[model samples]
Target: MTTTQDISQLYPNALWNWFAQICAIPHPSKYEAKLSAHIQQWAAEKGLPVVVDHVGNLIIRKAATAGMENCKTVVIQAHLDMVPQKNADKQHDFVLDAIEPRIDGEWVKANGTTLGADNGIGMASALAILGADDIPHGPLEVLLTVDEEAGMTGAFGLQAGMLNAEILINTDSEQEGEIYMGCAGGVDAEIRLPLSTENTPSGLRQYTLYISGLKGGHSGVNIHLGRGNANKLLARFLAGHANELGIRISDISGGTLRNAIPREAQCRFLIAPEQVTLLNQRIAQYEQILNSELRQTEPALKVRVEESDTQADKVLSLSAQTRWINLLNACPNGVIRMSDDIPGVTETSLNLGVISIENGHGRALCLIRSLIDTGREQVESMLTSLSDIAGAEISLSGCYPGWKPDTSSPVMKIVKDTYESIYHKEPDIMVIHAGLECGLFKKHYPELDMVSIGPTIRFPHGPDEMVNIKTVGQYWELLLAVLARIPQKTA
Candidate 1:
C-alpha cells in the first residue's frame, strides 16, 4: 500500500522522480506504447531532439558541454520495457495498474510485484543526465530499446545509421561494483509434444498437485544459486509416481517469462481414490527432499496436493503422460558448464522457463545462454536431441550474438581508472552470463566501444526485485566521473 509520495522522498530527486513517473505508467514488455509516448513527451518538454525508431526504440540527443565539444559522442542505453511478475495472491493488473513502490530499509521494492527497476532505474539515470545542466559531458544520446525482457525485438531490429555515438554506455548491469564489458548470447528452444487423451476412468478422483514458494529469480543472473524449478519439480513428482499411483494428467502449466526461473506450477490429474493417501505422502516426501537440497537458496519452497471440486471428463493417455513427465525430467534446467576463462562465471546454462499444455498438446519453452557460439550450439543440439527421442518437435528462435570482451579498449580503461580513482579500490571488470543489448549493438556498430554498469538490484524479473538506495548514488557519481574523463576523439 505504499504511495508515490513515499517513494518520492528518496535521494537524488531527479532520478527517483523519473523512475517514479516510469513506474506510474505500466510499461510491461511488448506493451510499451504508453511509456514510449511518455519518454517522447518528456524529451520534447526538455527541448531535446528525439526520434522513435520503427521498432519503438527511442533516441534522445543532448548537445555537448562547452569545453567537452571535442570528445566523442557517448550513447547511454537502457531497455524501455520491464518483466511483469507478481506474487501468486497479489491482485494486480500489469497493463493498467501502476506498480506500488515502497522503501524497504536500504532498498526500493514493489508491493508483491516486480519493481521495473531492472531497466527503469537505468533509463531514469539516462534521462536525468540528459536534463541536468550541472553535469559536464560530451555529446550524449540516450538509446532506449524496447522489449528487452521477454524479447530483444528492438535490439535485433536496431537500424545501423540511427545512432552516431562512438561510445555506448549501457546502464543495465545489476551490481554496483562490477563493470560488465561483455555478456552471454542466448536462443530460445521451443518443444511441442502432441497429447493423446482418453475418457476419465470411473471412480477416479481429480486432484491438483501444486508447487509454489520457490524463490525464482532471473534465470541468467541467479541460475547458479541452485533454486528449484517448479515445472521440473511437478513433472518429476508425476514421473516418479505415474505408474504406481495411476496418475492421469489432464492439464499442466507453469511460469511465464522464458528468462525467469519457474517459481510455481500446478497440474490437474485423475487418480484412484485408494491412492490419495499415497499421493499426499509422496508430495510430503518430495517437499522434504527438495527443502533439504535447496535449503540455502529456496528455503520457502512448498509442494502441495489438494483435492479439487472441479472434475474433468478427459485426461491425457497414460502413455502420453509418461512421455511428458519423462521428457520434462530429462530436460536440463541449470548451469551446464562454468567458464574456464573467467573463474566463477557460468559459461553455458539453460532455463526451462515456461511450460503449458492445452488442446491435446504441451509445449516447453527454454532459454539457452552461453558466452561462446559453440557452447550455445551444443546446448541447442542437446535439447533438440532430447526432444527428438521424446517424439516432440523442437525449434529455436531469437538467437543473438555474444559481445566479445576487449580489456584494452579506451572506454574500458577510462571507466576502470575513473572507478579506482573515486573509490580508492579496484572494481571487478567482468563479463556477465546474462544476455545484454551490448551484443546486438556491437554487431551494428562494430567499431563502437561499450560497457555496462548499474546500481545493485536483487531478484529482478520476480516479486522480490529491489534496488539498493546507496548504490544508486554511487552509480550516479561514477557515471558522472566517467563522462567527464572521456578522452578526446583522436585523428
Candidate 2:
C-alpha cells in the first residue's frame, strides 16, 4: 500500500511526510476524534509527553536541545481540524474518505476538494519540529486545537494558565515571507424566515433551477474578488421573475459552510406547462448576464435549468416566497468599508454563505468580519434592521474578538530580523482581514507575545486550496532560525 515515505520523496520530506499522514485521516471540524487519537498514538510511539485538555485541545511538550535550555519557553500552535469542501461532482465523503493529495507543478492540491493546507501544512511543520533530533530550541510546546473552522471552540475554551509559554508562534497564516500581527473579528448572523406551504396546483409542471460553477472562496480573504455568490445570483433571478412568471418555490438550498462563498444553489419551482419555454429563455439570458458580469473573476459561471418528472409535495405560499426573495435581495454582501489605516485592506465585509428551506421555514447564514468592533457592530445592526423589515427572526452567535497589531512587539522584531538575515530582505509585516486564533488566545493570556507565519497557501476554505512546495522549505528554515534566536530568560 502507498505510504508517506513515497510521498515525502519529492521535497521537504519532514513536513510533507507528516502532511501526507494527516490527509489520510478524516478530520473535518467538530469530527476530529479519530485524528486526535492518531496524534496521541504517534506521540506515544515517540515517547513524548502529551495531554488532551477538557475541550479536546492537544498539547505535546518537548525538551530543549543541548545548550538552549536557558531560553524562554515557546509555543508552536496550529489547529487540527480542517474545513471540509469539495466540488459539486466530487464523490469524496469528508467524514469518511481521506483527502487525495497530488502534486501540480509547484503546489500540492487535492482531487477537486479542499487540500487542508491552510492549517495542515502548519500542523506538519510543528510535528516535524517536535520530532527533530538536531534543531536547537528552548522548551517547546505544540498546541493543536480543534474546531477552528466552524468556530473557535478550542481557542475559546482554553483555560487560563493552561500554558506557561511567554512566546507563541502561530503557524496558521497563509502567505509566505509575511508576519501577521493582527486579524479581524467575526460574527455569524442567522436569519429564519417563516413560510407556509400548500399542495402543488394541478397542471403545473416541475423544474429545477441551478446556479453553479461560481468561484467560491474564503469569505474574508476573497470577499473583494468579485466572484459570484450562487445564492445571491439565484435569489436575484427568482425575485425578478417570480411575479411575472407565476413561479411557485418548492424547495431551495445552497452552500454548506458559513466561511465559504456559496458556489452552487438549486431551487425547484412549479409553473404552468406553457411557461417552460419562456422560463428557459429567461434562464439562458440571465446566465449570459452573469457571465458578462463575472467574466473577469469567474469565467466558468453557469446557470442551468432542467425539467423534473416527480412532483413536489408542497410549494411555498406566494407571499412567503416573495418575502424570501426580497430578503435575499435586500441583504448586503461583499466589502462594505475599506481600511483607511491599512491601504488595500478590507475594513468591513459580509458574505451570504448559506440558504435553505425546510418544513415551511427558510434560513440564511451570513458571516460578517471587520477590523474594528464598531464596524462589525454596524454591519450586525444593519442586518438586524433588514431582517426585521423582511419579517425574519435574526440571531448572532460565535462572536470572536479581533487582534490589534503591536508595532513594537519584541517577538515581531526577532522574527523580522531573522527573515532579513536569511533572505537578505525585510519580510512584509501586516494585519490580515481574516480571523485568527491569536485574538482568542490574547483574551486568555494577556501577557503572551504572539505572531503568525506559514507557507504560501491559496484559495483556502474551498476546493481550490493549494500550498506552494518551495515556500514550505523557506518557512521551515525561517522557523528554525527564529527558534534558535529566542532570547535567554533573565535572571
State every prediction's TM-score relative to the real structure. 0.99, 0.98
Q: Taking the tens digit of each residue's C-alpha lDDT, what string does model 1 give over 1-491?
A: 56877766677888998899999999999999999898899889989999988998999999999999999999999999999999999999999999999888899999999999999999999999998999999988999999999879999989889998999999999999999999999999999999898888899898888999988999999998888999999888877888898888889999998999999999998899999998888888999999898899888988988888989989888888888899999999899999999999999999999999966788999999999999999999999899989999999999999999998888988888999999999999999999999999877799999999999999999999999999998999999999999878889
lDDT value, residue 413 of candidate 2: 95
Model 1 segments beyond 4 Å from truth?
none
RMSD of each: 1.0, 1.4
**What local lDDT does model 1 show for residue 29?**
95
How many clashing residue pairs are found in candidate 2? Answer: 0
lDDT accuracy of residue 336 in candidate 1: 96
Candidate 2 whole-model C-alpha lDDT, 0 to 1: 0.91
